[model samples]
Target: MRKVCCIFIFCFSTYTTFAQNVASVNGKSISSKEFMWVYKKNHAGVTSASQQELADYLELYINFKLKVIDARANNLDADTAYKKEISGYESALKAQKKTSPKNIEYNFIMNEYREGVLMFNVSEKKIWSKVHDNEEKLLEFYNKNINQYNGNDFSDARGRVIGDYQQYLENEWIKTLRAKYTVKVNDDELKKLAKL
Candidate 1:
């Protein structure tokens, strides 16, 4: 019957939509399978997440997306720093590609690496250079946190002191980034992920 065919077509289309899409951001589709894959990968050692925990992670994921979107909008994606980082990764991957021509895992790893490199490039431009360039500030930080170090000689502890100072700068920088960005999540779409 014509009605039966129409009903079947509708059901099939609905199923396809539900199966393929988890969420969309600024016209970008986030596939349910990919989202679930990442969720499982991140929570591999854990038993299971409560609904609240999953919801929290969904918000974090959205925030992460917003950050990436912001980074791209600001032209970080086109910057030499980001391009160089990804080029380095691609060169490394080229060596492995010879062994496995159809490696799905490498695609996911490359996605993670690309995003990581973008974030690192942004941080380097925004915070890392300032921290590294200020010798006076580094010395002041070393003097303030001198007790935390072990060796008596300042030269021996310079690396540790600089690392701690960089961490402090990074924390402060993250606060600024959080304030700068706005993140929104679609609750209806987020709930669908919980079912997976």
Candidate 2:
């Protein structure tokens, strides 16, 4: 009876100690394993990161996730263009000689590719399209900043105008996304990552 009680206690402690998520955005949990995979790959295998470093990366990761969550909310991942582009990328990777097994690296690369495509598509729709498609906004901006343009008309200063407008739009988009989502970081999971 004592042995059974000990086993129950051990199992309960094990279950309580398990933490699956490092962060959650809009109630969708981001797994600790996924965070470790991404962070280690990006930081050159620095698993034993300091707390400050972990905090900094966690903030950056949360920001990235907010954008992706925004993208998902808008159903940007369902676009046919995204599907076609990802399909092409996968085909290209498959056609090339692989250094590792097909299933392992292939899945990781595809997941990253899907996220990249989502970010690009959403950004393009919410930011880049406005700059490229709206001549009126460009003209108004050019007229307002004519002194900076050396007397060039909107046609001649379109390049500079586009760059400035794109930056402004991107800043606004990030601000809106940050305002829209609530990112919750698991301090316990983050501390564990720092110690490791």
Candidate 3:
């Protein structure tokens, strides 16, 4: 009986080792062992990660890969504006990498402008563009989102609501603009990655 039990245990261990089908992209197979290794390479030693958290992160990696694939398919990679933006981002990252972490704050504040002129520029261009001073629009904005600007009257939250309403308007506008884009994720690859 003990010999039979040992044989059963050996067979089960072998089967379990062979059962893992790890690597896949959009339903295509990849090396399971390599996939697990890459997932661990990215995620191991993270203090906050549990087994489930590690699995979730692997799924995120797979989703990122899918998005990259779709982006390439749509010719977004060849877009001049995208190229410029990506190049600028990579250059900024490289520049940051050159500086020691201890000196990072100083570099970010002065050289990178932590919250200086560029913040103002972004606010003026992206955020402030949505704001308007017309009394009719203000009244309309207040009426549509009165709960947010709720108070005794316009006098109580005039300044607050104006900024809040403008931010809200910009957020909605961005969401609407995003509808022009299409996106999809591969659930199968994500699930397989999660196991790793």
- Candidate 3 lDDT over residue span 51-153, tens digit each: 4654566555444444444445455557686556555764676687765546633344333232223334344544575565556766777777778754547
Model 2 regions more than 4 Å off: 1-18, 91-106, 133-165
TM-score of 3: 0.36
Best by TM-score: 2
| CA RMSD per model (angstroms) | 7.1, 5.6, 12.5
Better of 1 and 2 by TM-score: 2
Off by over 4 Å in 3: 1-126, 132-136, 189-196
Which 10 consecutive positions of candidate 2 have the poorest summed lDDT?
A: 97-106
Give the backbone clash total of model 3: 0
Q: After superposition, how far is residue 94 of candidate 2 from its true place, in Å?
A: 5.0
TM-score, one value per model: 0.55, 0.67, 0.36
Predicted structure with the largest lDDT when compared to the true one: 2
Compared with the true structure, the alpha-carbon lDDT of candidate 1 equals 0.68
Model 2, 1-196: lDDT tens digits are 9999999999987545446678788877777777777888898877788877877987877877777778888988788987899889888887785833356556767777888778877887888888887999988878877898998888888999999888878778778887888777788888887887
Compared with the true structure, all predictions reach lDDT values of 0.68, 0.80, 0.53
Clash statistics: count for each candidate: 0, 0, 0
Which 10 residues in a row give candidate 1 its minimum summed lDDT? 181-190
